[model samples]
Target: MNNYEQVLVALRRVIRATDLHSKRLSKTAGLTAPQLLIMQTIRDLGEVTIGTIADKVSLSQATVTIILDRLEQRELVYRVRSEKDKRKVHAHLTESGGSLLDRAPQALQEEFIRKYQNLQSWEQNMIISSLQRVAEMMDASGIDASPFLDVGPINRDHEWKNPTQRDDRKPDPASKLKAS
Candidate 1:
C-alpha cells in the first residue's frame, strides 16, 4: 500500500482499539467513556466547574454539560452554584457516585500507563520526548486546530475557593504531500 494509505490504516486501528475499550468499559462499569472520563476528573478535582471539567476532558462546554446532565439524572452527581460567583456552577459527586467509582475498574486503556511505568526512566523520557516533537510538528503545520492550543490556557483560572484541586501534568499534518 501507499504511504498515505498506510497511515490511514494505522489511525483506523487506533480508533478501533479505543472504541473497543470504551464498549468494554461500559459493560463492566455501567458508564460510557465520556461519563467515566467526567467521573474520574471530578474525583480527582473535587467540586469542579463545568469549564474546568471541559478542559480536562478536551470537550466543549456544551458537550460536557450534556454529559453532566445525564450523570445528574442518574443521581451520580449534583451541581451547586459557586457562592463566590453565583454564575459559576460546580459539579460534585454524590454518595452513590463515590460508591460506583469504588466498584469500577481501571479503564482498559490504562494498561498503557502500567506498561509505560514499567519502562526504564530513559525509555519513558525518550518516548515522551518523541511524542512531544511529533505534536509540535503537527501544531506548527496549521492543522485546523482548536482554539485552546495547549493545556496551559485551559487551566488559567486555577484559583478556586477550595484551593485543593491541583495536579500536574493531538493533531494532523499534511505532507507537501510527502518528504519528512
Candidate 2:
C-alpha cells in the first residue's frame, strides 16, 4: 500500500476506536459521549448555568441547553431557578445522575489523555501538529468541534445501543502503532 493509503488506514482506525468506545459506553451506562461529558462537567462545576456548562465543555450554549433538556426528560438532572435572581437558573445532577455517573465507564478521551500525558513533550507536540495538519488537509480546521467523541446525534438517548451485540474487547491495538 502507498503512504497515503497507510495514513487513511490510521485515520480510520482512530475513528473506529472512538465509535467502538461510544457504543460500549452507551450500552453500559446508557449515555451518549456528549451527555456523559456535560453531566461530568455539571457535577465537577456544581449547580452551574447552561452557559457555564457550554463553556466548560467547549460547546455552544444552545447545544448545552438542548442536551440539558434531554437529560431532564430522563430525570438524570434538574434545574432550579435562583432565588436571588429570577433570570438565573442552575443545573444540578439528580441522585440518579450521580449514581449512573459513578458507574459509567470513563470517556474514551480519558484513556487517550492518560497515555498522551506519558509521552515526551516533544512527541506530544509532534502529534498535535500532525493532527492539526491533517484537519487542515481535510478542510476541517474551521469546524467547531467539542473535545468529546461520539458518532450519532449529540442529543441521542441512552436507549440507542443494540441489545443483540456483544463486545469481545481487547486493548487498543492502535495505541501500539507509531507513526514513522
Candidate 3:
C-alpha cells in the first residue's frame, strides 16, 4: 500500500479495536461506552448540567440527552430542575448509578491503557500533540479547541494523558474512509 493507504489502514485498525473494546465493555458492565463515560463525568463533576456533561464527553447536547433518557430508565441517573433556574436541568447519579460506576469497568480497554501508561511523560505528550495536530489537519481542530483554551495547555501536567480521561473513540472505518 501507499503511505497514505497504510496510514488509513492503521487508523482503521485502531478504530475497530476501540469499537470491539466498547462492545465488550458494554456486555460485561451493562453500560454502553458512552453511558459509562457520562456516568463517570457526573461522578467527577457532581451534579453537573447536561451541557457540561456533553462537553466533558465530547458529545452533542442532544446526544447526551438521549443517553440520559436511557440511564434514567435504568434508574442509574436522574435529572433535577434547577431551583433558581427552573429551565435548566442537571444530571446526577442515583445511588445505583454511583455503585454502577464503582463496579463498571473502565471505558478504555485495559490493554490500551496499560500500553499508554507505560510510555514516558515526553513520549506521551508527543503522541497526544501529534494526534491533536492530525485532528487539526483533518479540519476537526475547531470542534474541541475551546476546551483546551479554557483549561490552558491541552496536556497540562499530563492531564490529557490520564488513563481515566474519557476520549472520543475514533470514527468507524466507513466514516473515516468516506471522510478521506
Candidate 4:
C-alpha cells in the first residue's frame, strides 16, 4: 500500500484497538474508562474537589459531574460539602470504590505512558511530533481530548439497537463507504 493508505490503515488499527479494549474492560470491570479514571484520581488525591478531578483528568466540570452522578448512584463514591465552605463539594472513594479500583485493569493510556517513558528521548519526541502533525492535518488542533481513548458504547445498560435503526443517534459516515 502507498504512504497515505498505510497511514490511514495504521490509524484505523489504533482506533480499533482502543474500541475493543474498552469493550473488554467494560465487560470485565463494569466501569467505563472515565469512571475508572475518576475513581483512580480520587484515590490518588484524597477528597479532591470536582474541579480538581476535572483538571487532573482533562475533562470538563460538567462532564465530570455527570460521571460522578452515575458513580454516586452505584454507591461506589460519596460526596460531601466542605466543612469550611458548604458551596464547595469534594469527592471521596467509598470502601466499594477502593475494592473495585484494586480489581480494575490499568487504563490503555496509562500502559502507553509507562512504555513511552521507557523509550529514548529522540524516539519520544519523534512520536509526539508526528502525532501533533497528524492532529493538525485532521483540523483537530485545540480539541479538548482526554487521555482516555474509549470510543465504544457509552451506556452498556441501554439495550443494544441496530446502528441503522437508531433514530436518536446520527448516522456514521463510514457506513456509506461500506455500502459502496
Task: Name the candidate, 3 or 4, with the larger lDDT value.
Answer: 4
Error of 4 at 105 (Å): 1.2
User: What Cα-based lDDT does every candidate model obtain?
Assistant: 0.70, 0.87, 0.73, 0.83
How does candidate 1 score on lDDT?
Answer: 0.70
Indicate the TM-score of model 4.
0.81
Model 1 / residue 111 / CA error / Å:
2.5
Worst lDDT 10-window in candidate 4:
153-162
**lDDT by residue (tens digit), candidate 4, 114-160:** 89999999999999899999999999878767777787433233122
Please tell me which predicted candidate would have the highest TM-score against the true structure.
Answer: 2
Off by over 4 Å in 2: 158-180
My TM-score estimates for the predictions, one after another, are 0.59, 0.83, 0.60, 0.81
User: Candidate 1: misplaced stretches above 4 Å?
Assistant: 1-13, 114-180
Count of backbone clashes for each model?
A: 0, 0, 0, 0
Off-target runs (Cα >4 Å) in candidate 4 are 152-180
For candidate 1, the C-alpha RMSD (Å) to the true structure equals 16.5
lDDT of 1 by residue, 1-180 (tens): 998688668757765776666556566666765676688889999989999998987888887888788788678899999999999999999999888888876665467778889999999999878656656765754443332212222212212122353333212244344656
Better of 1 and 3 by lDDT: 3
Candidate 3 weakest lDDT stretch, 10 residues: 148-157
The best candidate in terms of lDDT: 2
Q: Relative to the unseen true structure, what is the C-alpha lDDT of residue 145 in candidate 4, on a scale of 0 to 100?
A: 76
- Model 1: colliding residue pairs: none
